[model samples]
Target chain A: MDDRSFVAAQDFLLSSKTFWTKQIYEDLKRTYEDAVARSGKTPTTPADVAAILEGDTLYRYFAWLERHLQRLKYAGRYGLVPYHDERRSVLAPPLRDTGAELSPTLEMPSYYRRVDIHQHPGGVMSDELDGYVYERGARSTTPLMGASHADLHHRFTDLVAAQDAERVLYGRILDMGCGFGKSTQPFHEAYPDARIDAIDLSGPCLALAAHQAPSRSSPKVRFRQMNACATDYEPDSFDLVTSTMLVHELPPGEIEKLFAEAARILAPGGRMVHLDFHAIDGPFARFMHYGHGLRNNEPFMQPWAEMDIHASLSDKGFTNIKVIPFQEAEGVDLENHAAWRFPWTVIQAELKTGG
Target chain B: MRISDSLILDRPEQNFFADPALDRAFGVVMALATEVYVQRDRVRALERKLEAAGIIDRADMDREPSEDERQANAEDREAFVEGLMINLLGKQQAKGAS
Candidate 1:
């Protein structure tokens, strides 16, 4: 198609009411109803009703809405006719301060604790639903699958490559909270010599991920259920430990425990890389990000973003701790020369040998 | 509207003149809005009918719906089809002279 025709086609796809009513809207409603029915209860409260709507379904629906909003916002800037609600609900209130709270007894706000649409048996972070939601959300945001998928895959690989490059051997790589194996598959593919173990707390998502991975013929990628904060793995077992978009879902205490676990599992010279959001420097940038967390039902995101991740890593006895801005499309940029990409960073730390 | 000899209306042209992305976004938004409006109207109508039938107390039923309850009922499939016409017609007008 010519440029004009292509643009026209794109416009039609975006604005066409029939497209949504006949396809996405209908399909989503059907899926929601089926899921609710499968759960076998008519919930009286919004929270209970939300629980019945599988996390994947909620994730997919929100993913769809988010993309639409992105397009609308993009279009609005150029006066191309804005589409979505410019004024929507803001993010929820910050967690009540419980100073010096050392335990994992921190109670998540009701909104944050509510079950996601993906029916993520627990919540967004711990289950296979995370993988499904992330994959579906990522794919929905970008339709051209090959390059987008490859870019993310390669970025993940580079993270692994940075750790075990000298030896040319990756003994075992553990991907904690390996949602749908999107971040996990790359480790296996990057180091074919290594065994990749993906862990999460959600059984349904794990089952789905297991089924999806082999169908795509990924090698040596295994999915299992285990909390990231407390895994059953032996100490110093994994040569490399990694997690993607996992840490933010956890509260402060859980996050500390997770780092401790990663530190425990890493052999000498072994590295821990966690792909997540970082506190963007400056006040205005910080405000925009915190606002995003509140409006998106991401209760812990703001706290996670504000926490000194580098300090956390260091406190856990990990050396060479650094919060490097990670360009998801292009791996870690040591020189830091990219512009106009989503704000994301990876916390890269190495477990100190003995003391 | 009289029924003529059975005619298939060429699957009403799917293309919207707007940007494909915009079309998709608007389509979903409009559909959702329409769905919400229709559902709201249906529930109101049902409540009215129930009141007329003496099934529910009119004064209690006449109270404005809670936002959360409205959201649930609006998206509820059981209450949706009854509300379809309002959304479909409303969307046509919102689409402009296309």
Candidate 2:
């Protein structure tokens, strides 16, 4: 119940997670290597990798650690859920005046409401204080990020900044699925001149995002509670449309709709870039990534990765489509680094100009 | 369209161990491990405070360890992990031989 106890408990969880990320993952990789070497056949598909590692005891422990570490992070004794729930009175008030517009009549998507995404007890949208819980829980999701978790978002924003010539003044920017505004914060700071609109299905998250922003940023960056697949914005409105770790949350059909919505709202020649999990290295990695989806309550990750993103973008008249591996941290080798990591990737495309 | 009431839903369960009790036992072990770590951290903090306030004579225990000692600590940690994961790993193949 004490703050120190809670802090210590969370710290222990983070250390355990780091152990899992490094040692357990490497051991499993070795197990996979040993399995294939004995079988004298290379795994060409996720199914092959699955067939090889599914029954192995170490593999089972690895998978169990991957799932339950996250579960314990948010829902265990001294977890973020109850900790924030206890402090709701103190924490919830500051979020109410952040200039976020709530949609009183917007219907909750069935997919969003069903599964507890990221194993956050009652989903991020259910409780008024769930946003606070998510914000705390997110700090330790990738154990490697430890105290530098915000660096990932800043790196993503920089990646987007690198591609644009007019970096100083982005006219209109839209950040879809901006949970607690972590992804949007970097954009707001980078393009202070840009008119930014951050939208998410969770009002609590939007409120927290708005609250986190500087008071003077009002009327410049508006946090709106709206769905990514459908919004009340006009066509050709946004100069730069983006989302971070959003697409993989949606089902394949919804992903298509979100792309269509982004295309429709983006101005001609506007850039649409998204940072998400994709571009996995091999079948072994793919097997782990998909298993992550099953254990982590993110059912859409595997489907999104398998979807023909290029064709989908081209279908929406997007040009200059580029899907590249994103280095979330500096000096992380995409090829050789052998720790458990999200296959961070960049998906980018530009709307075609008029003939 | 509305969110569910329970914290955990009856989704397709992922069972790593053969028996469900084993899965739960691991969870308990991890939870207990976290508690133990927290308690140790609290005690360490209390000791530091006591030393700072001149409540205890800890001059001999304040120094950093030698490089060899650090290496020994690292080996101890490695041994701990290996012991915890004993009997879980499978037999090594040719690639694993090296």
Candidate 3:
């Protein structure tokens, strides 16, 4: 497809997604409330809500749109996957000379191999230009996040930069699962003097990450292919360890290991901050989010939410742990916003230095 | 084989809708959504053509769109979604008046 048609198709998907989020979601929420009232049960769990409303027409339509809209976004006639496939030559490059390490032989964990993880044709790891594909597909990930998408990353960086200066200071950072460097870009920009080592399981994504980086950046990010669960780095290697939107892609067990690895690598008095989806607004939202996991091929989102990061962090002997709702936009994160949105939250914990 | 034809059926989300009518209706709505934006783009392109032909001045092109223009755009979108919603969901339910 020509550029005009391709962009038009993506814009259509974005508008359709906005309609689903703004209009259809409200209708579905009402249907859930009515169904729960009929069943005489105010749902306390997502399962309870699902049991009550999953069979309703509105809920089913919501589910169908939730699934197919994403598929349509990535795999439809002018979808990102095929579009990027055609532009593979434009996107593919040699990572070896770029100073980024590529592991051609790392055994992809079974959990990563099992699911497509975002309705992408192949998950982010498979195709050579899949990183470029992900970067494009991300443009429409949340329709509400249209032009202000860049601002969300900047807002998150502001939150991290606002960390209490007296508590923990950082000179070196590790960004886990930094796909295509989108999550890592702002950090490099914000703390240009601080060294950043970004690792992802996908070589394709790391290659793109390095390619996208500005060549002369001070403390330029070193992109490496490595599993977040078990990195080769020694303990106390990083003053700050972080990941964004990655924990939800992992099973609870892997998430546990990831936390252990981050904690192990974090210097004493160092912090770990992650921006991820959590803080589901209500029971209806919970029902939809869990069902979204089922429909979108992300098997672990609901389970990750259920894992309770605060408890896990506390168990690892971390101090000052907090899971707070992140304001992605000025007013959108408030509870009263009628549109459907990811329950963005910041989970932060600090390793303590004790006498 | 076309890349689009490759199997997406591994997950239940691929083809879970049981009713053919609803499924086809979804396809129609999505296609319509795509065309709606396409038309808007065409309109903008024509406006740009007018500016190129010196019909609409460069200053006018540089200026922000009027409130009237913004309202018209919003109304067009509202009408389109309202009609499309009514098509997918019958008028009674789609009206959604409390």
Highest-DockQ candidate: 2
The sequence of per-residue lDDT tens digits that candidate 1 reaches over residues A1-355 is: 1223223333433333234333554465556557668878655543553454325543344344533343322232211111111111211111112111112343333443563322222344432223343443344233322246556656767865875567475678888877565776667666776777888765534555665664235456667667778777888788788888788777777788999998887887788888887836543334435544543335567788868877888888899888877666535343442221234677888888872
lDDT string for model 2 (A227-281, tens) is 9999999998999999999999999999999999999999899989999998999
Greater TM-score among 1 and 2 belongs to 2
- Model 1 scores what on Cα lDDT? 0.55
| Candidate lDDT (C-alpha), each | 0.55, 0.88, 0.81
Of the two candidates 1 and 2, the one with more favorable DockQ, higher being better, is 2
**DockQ ranking from best to worst?**
2, 3, 1
RMSD of 3: 8.3
TM-score of 3: 0.83
Candidate structures ordered by lDDT, highest first = 2, 3, 1
Task: Provide the lowest-lDDT 10-residue window in model 3 chain A.
Answer: A90-99
Candidate 3 residue-wise lDDT, A195-248, digit = tens: 889999998888888877783254457888999899999988998998889989
> Could you tell me the lDDT of residue A268 within candidate 3?
90
Could you tell me which 10 consecutive residues in candidate 2 chain A have the lowest summed lDDT?
Answer: A210-219
TM-score for the first chain in candidate 1 comes to 0.62
